[model samples]
Target: MAAMWLLRTLLPLAPFARRMRHGMTLGVRAIAIGADRRVLLVRHTYSPGWHLPGGGVDVGETAVEAARRELLEETNTRAIGPLELHGVFFNPPVGGRDHVVCFRVPRFEMGPLPAPTYEIAEVGAFLIDALPETVTPATHRRLQEVASGAAPDDCW
Candidate 1:
């Protein structure tokens, strides 16, 4: 039991160590806007509130590929059309060396909404003007940037 606890406790440090060695880490987030003009958001079990579907970029995967994969995994939605790059933002809260590439998915095909998972508690599309109150501040800022035609800020 002590061994398991120790392993769990030290696991998070793995990413920091990897960042120190690799120099940087990258993640991807996708903004899937449906025909109704609603943007898809996810409520994660591991994290609080609603957020755009996204995850870390794997060793051999491009940012676009990671965004596509995260959308499908977190929302059961596939980006069937072109994914436009929104911006690359430095995610300071996660880490100074942690960066996130944002993509705007204008067209997609969703296989029915996903059920709750250990990673994702819920997934749904919401209007830009009426985001849920529990939505993460970062998420809200990102969406607001999208809605108002504002350029993505360099920092997240």
Candidate 2:
């Protein structure tokens, strides 16, 4: 009887503890680059600046799958494999438990892309050399390093 009561009490707290560990966490991004030097940007309906089309990696979803899902969800783009891990970023002094994994998608098809009905307000493709000024500082730095050949394939 005592053990049953203990298990019942602890089981309820188990999920709570797990959440606390992960934090009210989410993943997002500012930009995604594809081959042919094309950069993808999304104008958030709520936010003022333009950013890359990405969102939270759902529970039980892998990073690559999350990226692919976010890409299609936001811009209707098709990431047809050959996705490379670029880097993992941690956001601090902002929201809780936020982590973003950016990838260098090499082979993706810009399809009859649709305007995302979800959080995304607008989507556009741009040249890397002529990126917009609205990109976040972290994204800008990462892209610059990639452009200058300073960033490695796997940026942890």
Candidate 3:
């Protein structure tokens, strides 16, 4: 945990590191839906808008594994069934060619909300028709695609 903190403290150097990288990076974003159809969203300490719970995929981790790990870490939730691949996006907003594998968990079990951490500030399950105004545009786009059965596109 201390090591993670140290890395996070040094995260401002990430842009420079990305510029020196030679290849695309992979990430995972999970849209965890409850039995009531509400979706989970999180507010990160470093980012401005609420986003789906997820993070960069670790070196040896599958996208699904990364999604599950991120869900637990951010929301204390566990996927009880298979995670569906919602889409893959070429996310250029992060200053690199970040390929994000998006997943949807239709069923999950929730524990008590996690205590505030250095990374996450808040988390909650929100209804599709009543999302908070602060949700990121990309998150809203993903939800619309899921709801309307629209073909998934490469952009995010």
Candidate 4:
């Protein structure tokens, strides 16, 4: 948790720190809706509110690979089938060149929840009809899009 806090504090300086790097940055988020009709969400140590389990896509990692990795790392869950690409949205508020790829993890198995880590603070399977009020707006929007079968928005 302290590590993430430090990273969050240093986040604004990241643009300058990464000025040497070229091109856009990519991230992955996994959206898992269970047979019980609940959506999996996670709270991060560095950020406020609940969000889809995810993180940055490493230098050579594919988005789906990142999604599966993050889902297990953050929530002790594993995808058991193909993950469908939901959307790729520009996340300008996070960074000028940051874009997040969302995936629907339709077939997954959740192990017992892992204890909180430096990255993840908590995890929950929230009912579709009773989402937490503190869910991040972007996450909430994504959940709505999934629930309504609506086209995804361009922004994240």
Candidate 5:
């Protein structure tokens, strides 16, 4: 448990670690939608775009578990039912081929949204047609795919 806590605490340094590693890493992203069709998005302290709530998969954790954990930590939300696997994408955001597993939380319980922290700057749920202008292109694409039932691209 202590080891996991340490890993979570040092997660912000993952990008630097990725630059030194020679293999692909697995990460997870959650598409948490409410009953009214609004989707949750978060802005990070280090990044400039609004993105789905998620993070890197731990060494012994499954992608779904990582997605769930990230959603709970970032938005204080809990899935009320099974999560759907949206797709697996090869994301080259920081150079290496990092695969991100996208999950859809069709039903969930919302709690108080997280306050601004060292990692997350802001979080909110926005109507599908009224998303903020700063949303990441990849995140917008994923949302489109989810709405239209279109096939997702190989990359994120």
Candidate 6:
């Protein structure tokens, strides 16, 4: 009975399965913040939770490039040189993996901050110790480590 049920499900997704089998998976994520102790976050359109401003890495792009690109695209803020490597995490119980690069960015003191774009609805500097309630669990954990000054030179 179980075998028959599995076959039924597979039969309906045969075309999708074929397409997926030919696809390559790759991704990058970032943890960006400023010296003011405010981190960059985006409120996702699909999910109610807030997360770092990053997405999948393009096929030919380096993880660092992807992280910087995502941050600029999502928040219009450019990071300075040297992004610290925090941790790399795998998307468990799901597909793909992530190389999470963290940066303790300096504030945009040269000029006014740019408005948030993309799926982000709003953007503002918030105290790291008093983050909003919309942050995701994993993100919250990262924030805690950042706040506690315990994020060592190792993977999380």
What tens-digit string does per-residue lDDT give for candidate 2 at 1-156?
999999988998988898787765657443456666878877777876667777787889877888888888788788876677667766664464566777777677777667556577778787888888887666666677677877543322
Pairs with backbone N, CA or C atoms under 3 Å apart (clashes), candidate 5: none
**Per-residue lDDT of 148 in model 5:** 90
Model 6: lDDT equals 0.65
In model 2, residue pairs whose N, Cα or C atoms come closer than 3 Å (at least 3 residues apart or on different chains), thus clashing, are 30-52
List per-prediction Cα lDDT, in the order shown. 0.89, 0.72, 0.90, 0.93, 0.91, 0.65
lDDT minimum window of 10 residues, candidate 6: 103-112
lDDT tens digits, residue span 69-117, model 3:
9999999999888999999998997765788899989889899988789
The reply for model 4, stretches above 4 Å from the true place, is: 1-22
In order of appearance, the predictions have TM-scores of 0.85, 0.78, 0.84, 0.86, 0.85, 0.69
Tell me the spans in candidate 1 whose CA falls farther than 4 Å from its real position.
Answer: 1-22
Ten-residue region with minimum lDDT total, candidate 1: 16-25
State each model's C-alpha RMSD to the native: 7.8, 3.6, 9.4, 10.0, 9.4, 7.2
TM-score winner between 4 and 5, please give it: 4
Residues 1-156, model 6: lDDT tens digits? 999999998899988887677554445556666666677777766667777767777878987788778777776777777676666654543443323445444433222445544566665556787788878877787777767777443332
In candidate 4, clashing pairs total 0
Sorted on lDDT, best first, the list reads 4, 5, 3, 1, 2, 6
TM-score, structure 6 vs. true: 0.69
Task: Return the number of clashes found in candidate 6.
Answer: 0
Error of 3 at 147 (Å): 1.4
- Return whichever of 1 and 6 wins on lDDT: 1
lDDT of residue 149 for candidate 2: 70
Off by over 4 Å in 6: 1-24, 96-118, 151-156
